[model samples]
Target: MSYPISPPTVSFSSIIFTTTAYLLKYQLTRQYSNARMALAPSAPAHRVVDVISYLAAHPTVELSVSDIARGTGLNRTTCQSILLSLEPRGWVQRRSDLRYALGAGMIPLGEAALAGLQVVDELRAELDTLVAAVGLEALASVVSGDEIVVVAHARLAGVLSQTVRLGQTIPFVPPFGIAHLLHAPDGTIDAWLDRARVKFEPDERRAYRESIRFAEDRGYVVVLDVEARRRFEQAVSELADRPASHAARRRRDELVARLHREERSFGPWTGSESAEVSQISAAVYGHDGHPVAAIGVHAQPHQIDPSRISEHATSVLEAADRVTARIHGRNPAMSARRPTRHV
Candidate 1:
């Protein structure tokens, strides 16, 4: 039969247990300290990110101090204090009705931050896939200090003459440059044109005037360039018919032929000794529904003849939507060479 342990033995066991508990506590405390130290330098950016994340989750819903506090699990006073800090900077707005939403001023800052993050790599990779699938070229360009920088690009192997490279500057300003004008007030673009010493050809000038008026009317701009818009239209048109109708296939073939013709007229760029290049474009808006940037494609003219771009328009649009998201600071765009999650 077993007997109860003596008092001294029992005391020894209790001492061991206490020592083990203290050791574990020490280890856990040290680990937590290290983690806190690592995060300290990024605290402010983290807080701004937190604010942005909160806004993203609850867009278009009017938020109050208590609502924000409860949603973020912070104290009401703390929430109000943060909002106050954001207000003057135009990151958030307090309306006359006492409701709050994102501020108009926050847009550029958010866009700047998003651009700084290099999310465009993700977009380029996706575009590369599209190029292979469509047997054509896809590209993204950004306006950088008097040059259009082709930051991310993909092209089909069989096609040639696409000499565009990342970091290379194009003298021609992007058609979407008009966006800066639209976002500003009263002759801002005209003044900018004068300041930049830019002379617009008569047709180009008329086009810009017409485009700005049209964008204002529709609240957004969509380009119908041969590469992007034509492809999308072709895709939609193809989908309109089913079971591989002969008439539909014939129409698709015709559209593809048209794209080839456009490419030849537009190109000397695609290095192919034969099969010239064509391009198409479009633009989209933000949550506030403001036109942000233009999105489009460039491809070999012959590729357009089969309307092969239509087969890949969805991917092109997905990239464009991501770009639009970046414009509103919702996420990074593919053109910015930053890490962007798919929209």
Candidate 2:
């Protein structure tokens, strides 16, 4: 048997002295760093960043300097100064009417950022394997600010799955984007719930919160279970499958408006029996531990097979871990085997 190694013991007075020395050193280092910062030229780069952020949020809208200043909470002169600096570099463009909007210069930076993400090809590979194993349409979506964009996918042949388009973007609405939202930074849920067109009831809000908690703890989210869920998924799936004609678009919008006013359809479920499982999603994390992607598998919305729920959740979790490894680490290794399926 291997003996437990013990840490070295230290005298009380020696510990006290060492602590004092460390405290003194820390104070001195902090003071020196603060002094250096104070002496350095102020770049006002943060103000520029805020302005760019504001413009990005309203990408299609041209704003006057005052509008930008109000949005950024910066003074008019400061906003003007920053815009002046940005205009020369083509970061922001001044319209003929003197209004400003985000310029084409940002395109290359956005392109470079997208190009730098070498995960797409690897993510698609993972989705293909996952779809094959789970026999459902497996999709990979990456978070982009307030939106989740489908980047890669593997759809099973002969399945009546909804068509998926690459680069399709969906807002982080309730009963959606939970796989990413569950691991999001604080305030994300509040923002998500608030984004709803209609205010949710207390029970509804609590249920949504619990669904996130379930996904957080269980490493997967179960979307639908009851027969009511089946009907709801069916309606949504029908909308998704609508043709791209103008009449279909208008009709879809009308139906979406009706659905938006209705109570959010999904939340956490607890049962010995299995859920219908319209869709199950697992989170993929980057090195920073923020959710980078969500790997989701769409089940037969009407099927209530209990066994597949457990099996499918495990497969997605494994796919998530492997995708996380390929993108964030050198080797494709999961830190742990997936938890037992039922739990």
Scored by TM-score, the top model is 2
lDDT of 1 at 141: 51
Query: Per-residue CA lDDT of candidate 1, range 1-343, in tens?
Result: 2222212121211222122122221233232346346322344433444454344334457778777665555567766777888889876788887767766655554344335424354444455554554555666654443434344555554445334333223222324244333444445445444433235566645555665654343222333334542453454333222212355445644453454323223221222323322454334444544333344566533344423333344455556666665545332222332111221
- Alpha-carbon deviation at 314 in model 2, angstroms: 0.9
TM-score per prediction, in order, is: 0.37, 0.56
Specify the poorest-scoring 10-residue window by lDDT in model 1.
Answer: 5-14
Q: Report residue 191 deviation for candidate 2 (angstroms).
A: 1.4
Candidate 2 lDDT tens digits, 1-343: 2222222232222222222122222233232346346443234744665576566545557899998887767889999999999898787899998899877666555444446556655686787678767667677887655556666656655454444444444446665677877566668788888776567888877777777776677677766645444444445433333212244345534443444434333546553464445677878777767676788786554453666677778888888888878877321223554545544
Best by lDDT: 2
RMSD of each: 26.5, 17.2
lDDT of each: 0.43, 0.61
* Model 2: CA > 4 A from native: 1-114, 158-160, 201-203, 225-264, 271-274, 300-304, 329-343
lDDT of 2 at 325: 82
Enumerate residue pairs that collide in model 2.
none
